[model samples]
Target: MDIGVALRDLGQVDSTALIERVLGFDEQAWVENSYRQKQYDVHTLTESVVMIFTDGKGWPNIEVSKESGWDLLADVAMPLMHKIIERHYPPGGTIIRAMAAKLLVGGVIKPHVDAHPSFHVGHRIHIPITTNSRVRFMIDGKPNRLAVGNAYEINNQKQHSVMNKGKEDRITFIFDYVPPEQLQRMQQMQQASQ
Candidate 1:
């Protein structure tokens, strides 16, 4: 997902509905899918309501499926996601992961690259639903502030992290998208292996 840059500002969008929807979820929803936090030590202070996720136990060929959050957020999230995609990405890409991730007040997502094979190719897009001035998103040792209503594509291959020193929790809707060309290449590779 390294677009040869630290951050690519994909401009702004109307996230009012998405924001309202995310705020409606109960506290229990955030903890329902603890996979990200459990697997990555850096995300221990974070909680997520994962909508679509991939089954990539063996790597390369992955299976994507809808999780619990899909029921809660898809109606509002999908339209926004699609709008972003239509404007910024190629048609017919697959979203391997989609979720509303929260960094609790005073939490820090220690700096690290997204090392998974999927992350190497997919675009890691983020839309901040709620953020405070104190939240700093650092990429490669530099601090960048991501605000609400704006979308960004981050280079997940490089070291990146976030720290929420604000009084309110920082929430962002993130998704990993594999453009059609990249997806076709992966499919061919998988078939060749078989």
Candidate 2:
């Protein structure tokens, strides 16, 4: 699977609520550099990420060696997060990480594959809150634009990159989870469509 579908509508949820909460954070709250900063510092994609939920050790620790914990920001964003989880995931899907990622205009994420063990075999879902047509999320060279309020499952295991050529910032609520059957079903659906 490449650029995936919206699997679920997710249209009724007010995406602005999540966007407002994300924007409420102070400048210092955003994690400017990607975790793999050493490798691609020159063309680094700057994202203002507010980690709402993460492994116990906190942000930048993508590998969950222990139990997970909700950050302080999660309290403010819990209502919307629950709504998202309920809509997409099963009763007890394992949520590895959840964050509000904001990319500024002209920002670009150089092509790279997230090859971590945590990323493999899991689904990375994006719920775009504020975005425009110029925001291109490329998966294996094909460009994809996720409209506001819609959810998309991106195949992060493949080489992918993002560029926001629009004037407004592109904000998305990203969630990583290991669904028992939904991921398999989505892949099958993609194959059938192809």
Find the candidate with the highest TM-score and give its number.
1
Error of 2 at 104 (Å): 2.5
lDDT of 1 by residue, 78-158 (tens): 998899999999999889999999999999999999888899879999999999999999998899988788999999998
Pairs in steric clash, model 2: none
Alpha-carbon local distance difference test for all models: 0.92, 0.63
lDDT of 2 by residue, 66-147 (tens): 2121353465556666676687667555666677667778988878787554566466878787888888888777877678
What's the TM for model 1? 0.97
Scanning candidate 1 in windows of ten residues, the lowest lDDT window is 54-63
**What lDDT does model 2 reach?**
0.63
Q: Could you tell me the C-alpha RMSD of candidate 2 in Å?
A: 7.8
True lDDT of residue 62, candidate 2: 40
